[model samples]
Target: MNTQTLKKPDINILKGQTITGKWHKKKYYVVKELGSGAIGTVYLCVYQNVQVALKMSKQSHSITSEVNVLKAFKKVQGHSLGPSLIDVDDYISANGHVYSFYVMEYISGDDLPNFINRNGQEWLFTLLIGFAKDLQTLHDEGYVFGDLKTDNLIVSRKPARLRWVDVGGTTLQGRAIKEYTEFYDRAYWQMGSRKADPGYDLFALAMVILRIYYPNGFSRGDNPRKTLQQKVQLAIRSQSLKQLVGKMLNGDIDKADQVKDYLLQYVMKQNQQTQLRQKRLSQKNQQETSFHPTLEVVSILSISGLCYIYMTLFL
Candidate 1:
């Protein structure tokens, strides 16, 4: 049998199967497939009774660099941008072929766009600021998240936060971006090179915001660049920080702090409005409660007087 046929069997990881680490011998129970991409397949798994995400790739070499990148990210103390790398190992199948896999914290949440739709768009300002800060952290560490897109982001509540899931596109500074979605790629817009820099990520970040703002309208036509530019102009009218977003799309905004500051201001303004509205509602409710008893007492007395009159007249 050829290599393609040999690797084919390992790709279909059945549910409930156990994948054991080659070196440490730790075993993880496969729960279900989470997602699949060009490089590998990810599965939800339980390791030592704790939920984790396991990524398996047929070509082990393809993910070796990503593993190193993740290790570097893990060293950044208090980094909440993405899930912590748990373990790395290779699993030997029954046929004795080695398949490489790595485990990371399982993020339980909806994707960025879905979460916004479900939770309400009022949270977008906070979410975007948090996301920009995360990118800032990564950039500060001398790395670029080449493929920054909504699908790669997860937003959770109970302490609403955002986390990056797929780290395959992460690359060190000065290197060309390894991977990117067409719409999110700066090169696709002919605005800049694909070099892994802060500008590249910032440009993609701006695209992400525009996408969330106009999900259906931003389409890829024959003239994709012109189409995107038009969409950006329209988005500016509908979205806050129009000039900032325009600058970002043009590869002008590189500092994440700039975006964060603008978005933070918007979030604070929205929060104040919400609080004021809530306070007014509370006062209205209080007034209605205070007036309710007097009306009830007057109504009871009127009914009693009517009953007495009826008794005197009819009895």
Candidate 2:
């Protein structure tokens, strides 16, 4: 009776440590920190042993824009580029900051942006096909991934096929969700031009393909800056980069297939040949290095044998 009456109370302790998960009335357990945005930190969360992305707000109206943009995509008849929504929760932070949390589908793969930075040219023609198709789809639906850099894209994490992810629909993808009428990305800048415009995004896409799939001994980025601009612009008439502008407006991109084919055929093949040539040169150097050591040793042995014979004869 005494032991039962004097039981010590157990208190949940979470002091001094920044942990992510369903904590203190939260719904999920935080596994690892993926990244942080203008809002709060994004953590790889777990619930029932499953994974998900929990993005908590950093400031006012941050999650509102993201949620609005995501909701806009859901209204579209057929769109699967963006991550599927799971759940949303809102609360006030310890510092009196009101924040919203979004539970999003967790993509188990390498982020495309990081992959491109590391291995951009390993598989040229294949990635071009999928990427071009997705870009066309986005164009048809009047959405441009504001940030088209490699980091925004996702490739396979294991030794499997590379995949692209993070489809930002509006100019920011996380911008004003209600205003979906605009089909242009404002951050794209023309090479010789000043402001960032919609056409710049298209040019950016083409540039990504060109830089990654250029198939010559010279490579996509090896050429002088102006020369590269000239090469890309050559296919787009008018010294300006307006090739993608007309097609984007027309809402018809059947011609893009031909362009992708031409890029892989002309660009990737030439680049592969160049890489092969360099590899052969390296192998030849190794062979020369290997042969040199053996020859030096044999020459030394021959000289030593002759010296001993000559010394005996002289003695």
Candidate 3:
């Protein structure tokens, strides 16, 4: 007899189900569905009384690929850009269908757009700097974040740094980008190809910058390049920021480290200019103060001399 097709588990039914790893023998209590992606569905679950994120999918190959990516993240030096891979195992559902699943660190934070809106635009540069560094690490390790959008990013509190999530779209350098959103895709804009490279990610980063300015996102008109440039001019008043983003979009700045360096240099130049202006103003104020006191003294002396002359001539 042919086996019955296994349908995607309903959220309501999965909420209270216990997922026991067939090999690891660890159990996780499903709290709720965090998100559903093309590859699989991620759930917020409690493992050994601690909250974590677990992704399960019938496609075992895709699940294994994502698990390898997570492992690669751990091998990268410095910061861990992606979530830490906790456990990898198989779970059998009530229907006796085996599903591949992996548990990862539960990153609790606000999405990029909401975080920036609530905290104000002051956080944009800092977040961008941190994000560039993280991206640099990934690129150095031979990976490109194909789907570079705000939706796949999270801002954690305390130190308030940017963190990447939903890394399923990450692809190795030189290969075709596995997945991408059109708004952020250079190919969609007719600016470049779909081949995975630093430029591809940088172009997406530029779109992400625009996404902040146009929260609802703009449409690609008759000319995508012209449309993007017009929007950049309209939204970004800062010449430096506009130039940086423009370079990224145009593929002029292709590397993540270059982005970081450019931002840091701009920030440094701005600080120097501000300090120079402050110094000049301070000097001008000091000169005015000295002139006022000297003028007062001269006035007093002139009046006393006139009074002495009057006394000498009349009395």
Candidate 4:
């Protein structure tokens, strides 16, 4: 095969291509394309028995922007709420297109956005609680998801999974952002004009939760709730993302500490219960194996008598 025969891909090769459904890598067969974005395209791929979602850059250097961010997330402190990147690969396509690919656990289920679209306001708080639990755990581990957008967040039912997809090219190490920027307007994004801080991250999450609660005036006015149905509707739509967030940062909603306290209490009670159960089981096992002299002697004598009776009858 003459490698030179392939046409060089520039603006023309990928011109009509949808970001979501092209195969640059064949080591794993791409089942189908799922979604697309400005930076990369996502494909549902299969590797043996495992089903995974793989993403590759449409642009050469931009892929590194996301890859670098994902690498940082890997170092994040606690239980990351999303799928860990299993592999990152780079190769040339048939059109002489150079690409870098990222493989991640294809989270099975609908996203939180879709859920919000289908469900009611009642689910938002419950979902946010789980999300906060997972996110704070990640921050405590000294890492941020970079961009905390709803598109980057995947949700499941019963057992909630905030599948953290990687950085949306949003990376700041606790001291980079300074003041307001256009990007910081989103409920989960912070535009720091001075420096990046974990506090900003909390503010972002609060913004996201509040948007779920109040969509209309999350930025300036009230969330536009005239009726119960409208109020419920507001709870589901993801709005002005930027303005709602700005409003939230300026507002007086305090959720971080409260959720933290609740988590501590819940974790402690669970540990105590686990320990008590283990201790009781250990005691029971010890008693079962314990040597009781009276019972042991009776058991020996009964066995000897039975053996003698059998021998005498045989004789």
Candidate 5:
């Protein structure tokens, strides 16, 4: 065998290494790699005895843009729509190359598909409503989530919360979208441009709904738009929701507020119907239980009287 030395990994933070915040000087221990994409890799870490997610980018420019977008989101932190930014810093790799990274709130939850699997699909209406409201908040803040998708969304239980991750695609309104998944992109549907608009995000949201409703058929190697339209028409019987989905596909994403309101109404109506159903069921059960004992007593008394009279007559 030829004598050669193994080289260390380049520009990437390895697991178990300690990363210190440049400003606060707080140290975080890397647990494991959460994910890796074109721009960067995310790691689960422990900071101040609390778990947090840290994103390290290969290119300094990419991390810089993402950090700025996250900073903007911080200005409107009251909404709690996206993960809270913790800190930003630079790390020197084994090869002496400087890499940029940022820390953010670690969301402990399942993605959309897994969440539906665990919670049942009945909660979809409420989940979508919450997501739409978050998007509305981002829109109100003059930003658009360019890369909205199932993977980027995390849903929590108990209270049923929704949160967005991956700020690299965030863009200011009226500019071209910085990034997007092809299936969720309006340009792929031949419906609109790649401009960063509220409608663009809405179109992606529509795709998200379609994916949730028809997990297997949404991307079955056919014309996605046509297939989606046909499936929605055949499967979804609710006229109001169908109309909302149609508007989203048609690039009318500015109507997110309307969709949100409609979903809210639907959820409220469902709750009322559920309560009514439960009440009726309880009453029916109560009535049956009350009637059966009286009937049993009357039958026993009649049988006893008949038996006594028959014995007297025979004797």
Candidate 6:
């Protein structure tokens, strides 16, 4: 999430301004600035008595590319990985400067790292599993989440689902990645190219895991691959977890479904081991309970025999 720093927009000027769509004629009252990036600034706005996110950019082509990504996300069949595109139009500012903007579903949730910190690391695997499933769905549609990072992932409650945000980096298979953060980019690690592919996204996912564990983030050392391998070994002690991440980082596991299956198997194995330990402890308690009663009875009988012998001898 700390991958890149963007110049923030002036909230004092952006807030309280009413943006009226030039063609659609829809009005959105800007409540606050949500975030800003190289492409545009996203604002939390009120539209038709409902809160929504509005992204405004001076570049029309960038807006069109992002809109296309959002449209592609809608076709993933029953899964809304990113926000739904609500409205798109041009806006004329007070100075007559035109800007392209799009309104979308406002996802009210925590970013992945903050959500994990608040809820505890126990939710880490479940959240990663959700990411893998969503990635798999996107891959099945012939697209890759080129910039998969903790900053781009949000964890929404009510059902606690993981969703994608800021899909400006999404690209069709075999194309150059539209955008990326160096920390999560394969090219930065010198492991692969910046081409849009399943392996590229998987590598980013591995970096996301490292970011979660090392919230302070890390730098690429003299040996980038060795540095990453050492960091992974330090953070992950579980053999299965380490193996899955290693596969992703090494480009051995390119398919999202493969990563998902590996994680499920690891979880199932852990559950079984937990149940076995509980069963063994229960049996040990039962044996101890039965042995205590037998010991008490034998001690009482020995005391009674000693008393009778003493009385008979005295008589």
Model 3, 148-177: lDDT tens digits are: 888888898888988888888899999999
What lDDT tens digits, residue by residue, belong to model 2 across residues 232-311?
55444322123443343222333445445555565567778899999999999999999999999999999999999999
Give the top-scoring candidate (TM-score). 1
Better of 2 and 3 by TM-score: 3
lDDT digits (tens) for residues 1-315 of candidate 4: 544223434322232232232454336666777777766677788766688877776565566666666666667645554666777777565655666677777877666656765785445555655766766665555554445555556675457655556455354556443223222343323223334445555555644455445433333224322232243344534443333333335443333444555545555675698999999999998887675666898899999999999999998
What TM-score would you give candidate 2 relative to the actual structure? 0.52
Error of 3 at 289 (Å): 15
User: Which sequence of candidate numbers ranks them by lDDT, best first?
Assistant: 3, 6, 1, 5, 4, 2
TM-score of each: 0.86, 0.52, 0.83, 0.56, 0.84, 0.85
Q: 1-315 in candidate 5: lDDT tens per residue?
A: 521212324356678999875556778899999998878889999997899999987677789999899889889857786888989888765566566789999987888877877787667777888888888888999999999988788887567887788878899999999988887888877778999989999988888877777675355245756766787797666776788888888766475687799788877888899999999999999999999999999999999999999999997
* Cα lDDT of model 6 by residue, 43-82, tens digit: 9999989999999887777898999989877776678878
Backbone clash total, candidate 1: 0
Question: What are the lDDT figures for the candidates, one per model?
Answer: 0.84, 0.51, 0.87, 0.55, 0.82, 0.87
| Best of the two (3, 4) by lDDT | 3
Candidate 1: lDDT over CA atoms? Answer: 0.84
Of candidate 3, the 10-residue stretch with the lowest lDDT total is 4-13
Candidate 4 TM-score versus the reference: 0.56
Score candidate 2 by lDDT.
0.51
Clash pairs (backbone) in predicted model 6 = none
Give the lowest summed-lDDT range of ten residues in model 5.
1-10
lDDT of 1 by residue, 235-272 (tens): 55535667778888886778888889878887778789
In Å, residue 247's CA in model 2 sits off its true spot by 13
